[model samples]
Target chain A: MPAVVVGPGVASGASPVVSVRQVGFGYDGRPVLKRVSFDVGAGDFVGVVGPNGSGKSTLIDLIDGILQPQQGEVLIAGRATREYRRRDLAREVALVPQSFALDFDLSVREVVEMGAYCRARSGEVRGDAEWTLARLGIAELIERRFTELSGGERQLVVLAQALMQRAGLLLLDEPASALDVSHQLRLFDLLRDLNADGLTVICILHDLNLALHYFSKLLVLSDGELAAFGPPEEVLTPETVEAVYGVRAYMHRHAGRTYLTYSPRLRGERKGRIHVVCGGGTGAGLMRELVDAGWEVSAGVLNALDTDEEAGRELGLRMVVEAPFSPVGDETHTENVALMRTADLVILTDVPVSLGNARNVEAVCTAAREGVRVWAAEGVLAADLAGATGALVESGVELHADTAAMLAALTARDGSQRPA
Target chain B: MIRLGRTSVWPGIVLTAGVFVVCLLMSLAFGPASLPLARIWHLVTAGPVAGDLDSAIFWQIRLPRALLACLVGAELAVAGVIMQDLFLNPLTDPYVTGVSSGAALGATLGIVLHVAQFPWMTVLALAGGFATLGIVWMAARRRGRVNIFILLLAGVTVSYLASAVVTFLMIKAGDDMHAIVYWLMGSFSGRGWTEVELALLAVPLMLIPLFRTREMDILLQGEKRALELGVEVERTKRLLLVTAGVLTAIAVSVSGIIGFVGLVVPHIVRLLVGPGHRGLLPVSLLFGAAMLNVADLMSRTLLMPNEIPVGVVTTFVGAPLFVYLLRRGKA
Candidate 1:
């Protein structure tokens, strides 16, 4: 058969390059992919991500036509994948599997040449074996044995073979799993270059950061079902991640790029609630430790755009904020007092006191006087607080030298509150 | 003329073909009653004149025996290549997969039944071989997938069972025991035009895999990977398995259970050329023919009147060479 010269999605005319319609596949009656439906347009770079056993690899297999769906169908180039001959479908889609049984001693050139097995000699639209290897920057490996190369090099050679097919659509199942950081970056960079040249790529990635950073779109799967699918920023939201992965995660935008940070939810281990009065990034580390140690923490009276406020917001803490560079207003002070009133303990970070933020120290002292446990990091605030520090000592607020001493003092206090 | 470079296999193919031609001529000339090279060439050109002693010796006996050995050797070696690649195990050979043992059982049965005639023994051997292949195939199949490890295990298990049955038949054949023992030892001695004709069927079977060289090369990665690379893995596997089975059955019927040649020729050829089936398959085929005929030539002429079984000759020559190549390969 003559080679089908489809440019990316041209084989389907106006349709998508890949249309997976309600596909369900199972092995030995155990379902792996269930009713999964999606479409990849021409030149789309998509990353498939999910927890282990979430049908990520199985979806790649279905898309590349290695395994047919037991229910519904996968259509490549608008034709049902099973209807096309193996060679013809190969001309349309090429897959780089994670690994293969490679015990045979074959030269790199021979293995790469096998990619052109389906096409006629004259129709080798992708260039020769050496040319393809040269394109991958591994042309010197042409005469080397495949089994003699390193894991990353073998993967690159296999990728070169897949490219030699000149398929419009490429599917990779964790192609970066065995690669080092540098090679992983190189592999994805090459994939992006090929995608820019009108090749549609759908890769199954284990690293969510890489997925968000490299791919134009993300397909999130959970428990053999589609969790979400859209642009990476929209599809991989904190709510979706927490719901699907059962972990608390938040996104922060820095330099126009979003990064996701995750913290495990200690279910049923809710330690007592504590309100931390902090600023200038001092509370960031303490807040993270408290949260990880099962303390339900809230922060208060931080100025807008303060470092601690950013950390608090990134950690998804309930925080009371004042205007930037402005004094803590009476309303915000009242909110901070209300938060401290319900707390089992109140933590005060060592921020240099001034008229603008003096209310935070006052609120901590008031909470301490009202039978709430209060711990403060000792600072020059001992001198700067002046009469306020004296009042704090009189109110029975325990001041520790640093966070370690404070945490130790808190652990020693345990369930009992000492008398003032 | 063999080019040891990475590019073309034409020179390797030409070299092996030349070796085959030399071995075939040498095999025809140096048997029990030796014929001069010039006289042998005249007799071959004269083409089987009647009532001529040298012509009868050349055409009726030596020519057919040599051709039968060459064909059977080529058949077994090609079968070995297919089976080894299909099973994806370097240790696999045609006999280890139970096909040859099953054929041996059928031949043993034919010898015991006093129907050791031309076609009956060959037919029954073929039927037995296919039956074992079907049984092993079923044993390895689960839900529709053929598990290769299980297939190899089943092949070895079935091989043992058939060998056990052949042993029992040998113990039971009191008067016909000598003929059974001689057949079990595997020889191309006294085999003539009829056996050559039967062995000629393997030529087409051997040629079938040449068209599938690309698929076979892809399969070196494995079946699942081959499928992803656009090879119809199951269909190709079925066709190659059947070809190997038929070749083993026909060869076993004509020349009995010859060992070593099938197992070692592929490894030798692979060392000479690379493992690309384009070079590996044809080179192994031609080299197998050359190797076996030389082995046969040595077997018939070694002790003058008393001939050792050709199987012993191959084992003696092949075993040391295989170990040396293996150690050298490790280095």
Candidate 2:
């Protein structure tokens, strides 16, 4: 089929250069994205937002030519993403993925120059990296090692690298997840300026305020499906945000802008004995294993029924689940941990440490020293447990990768115990 | 920590010059022929002294072996540096890509079939290395790109299969076991100038192109990122891999299977210096040349007249360092 160009979200009469028609994506026959279709127009800045794992990264990969859609095609400038040469597509579209591996000491300028890659001919450099750096206002950071840059600065450098190609389409996956307020504003301004200059931008953002104030269009994804599409106010309503993110949110107006505070569907208030440092799919298998093994597994702070918590629910385990995804609250951490002490064995599942739940690793370490079986997972990146598990490891507790191994020792067959 | 200022290439050059002199002196002083320095000098300064058997042995046998060590060592280290760069992995040396394995499998074919007794060793090694590399490259490639995540896994598979073919040949050759395994493990003893001259022909041809492009620095950005930057990512990576394979195949053809010089030397140099292959390559070349000569010296002296395979001696030293580096912050 010829690419369907929609003019609805496009500026007045400007038609979409790239459009999707009833595209569905799944992995290993399990559907994550279903019958999804959206249009990206000329100079349009579309903000695709959803909770984590809502097919945001997957969609970007598909658009970037790293992955092929099993059902429908991703069109660029009315042509299939693959029909054009990989370089040709690169010249037209640029991707700024969130993953950062600054292993080699490539300077910021060198990274930005990498943006002009597809357009660069052998024995010749376009020298467009300078202009790109100048545009991002990171011209001063050009010669500095990329790893030495701050989190906010690194984000800008990556943006410069992505935009230096002068690609018409820019696909950013969660551009401001770890930025401070000032940096987030600066990043948004950069995106807005680029959009105003006739560059089509698609930014994946989690903040509703930024999307409402900055982006001209919004695309909300839920469980890998398109939950809502249109202007920020229309799509940022309590119902849409709640349905997309699975929580109860109140849309309140402040300084002529609508801000949302989402609260999850509350279960009955309870005080129980079970301290758990649980998050991510890292704990999914172990949570089921423990629950099925007949332990009272009450999770300390799970945002909601994540893939892991979903497994917990299937096994009929009573977890002190956090409702932050559905409800915005400061008391969720306190409330969840109140029930943490009731558990006899404090199991520390191997979850990656980030600013999001860095304290969870700490909680396990503290509980383990108080005579809890604090077996750490091997094969976990030290950076993931940078702050929390270090002290526990020093205190004679070993860091292991397999929870099954840890569980086996905790529930040993017969009687051969090591010096714990 | 007195910061060793920046690693000066001048220091490397001077150190390399010093290492060359020491190797020359050691080459002259010891070996099968007990040479006196005065007589060696007299043989060089004066045209063929009356009793210059020691000098002839030194000039004909030791000099070539030492030079061959320089060439093979430099070639293997540079090949390793390039392989690590292409993979964007510091731990992935040349063997991980199955380049050396391919060459060994190739050379072993000729040796087992008695074809290697003639001049078919290079042909077989080149054909085997290139062919296995081709099979590996094809199998590992997905969507016109070398997916190293799977490429490493595929290389392991290729190495396994090729080594099995080699093991099969070793079993069949039975009586030639000493010759087959010794050459396969690699050795540089008793080599002459002709072999050294033959090896010099291949090393410079392969390394010059790599030095010119200086692609390792750019390649570390990533294949997709590098491609986007106007680097013909697929072609450049393939060329780099092929050059490295050819260099390694040449080294294997000369030295047999001198293991870990390609793996540990580049990594050791990188730890001392940094990951910039431009400087790292030259530095590793010197360090590797020095290391192999020293190891060869130890092997010859440790068991007088009955030398161990220089390859086994290196692994004995390298495996410990490999484990040490793995623990020390991936340093």
Best by DockQ: 1
Evaluate every candidate with DockQ and list the scores: 0.58, 0.15
Q: What TM-score number comes out for model 1?
A: 0.91
lDDT of model number 2: 0.70
Clashing pairs in 1: none
TM-score of the second chain for every model? 0.96, 0.86
| Model 1 error, position B65 (Å) | 2.1
What TM-score would candidate 2 get against the native? 0.65
lDDT tens per residue, model 1, A136-251: 78989998889999988999999988887789999999999989999999999999998999899999988878898999888888888888877788778888787778777779
lDDT of 1 by residue, B90-126 (tens): 8889886688888888888999999988788878777
Model 1 residue runs over 4 Å out of place are: A1-13, A121-127, A266-269, A326-331, A350-362, A377-401, A405-420, B1-3, B49-53, B117-119, B138-147
Provide the lDDT at A277 for model 2. 61
* B36-99: candidate 2 lDDT, tens digit per residue: 7786676667654446676666667666777787778778888888878777787777777676
- Evaluate model 1: give its lDDT: 0.85
Model number 1 iRMSD: 1.7
Give the clash count for model 2: 21
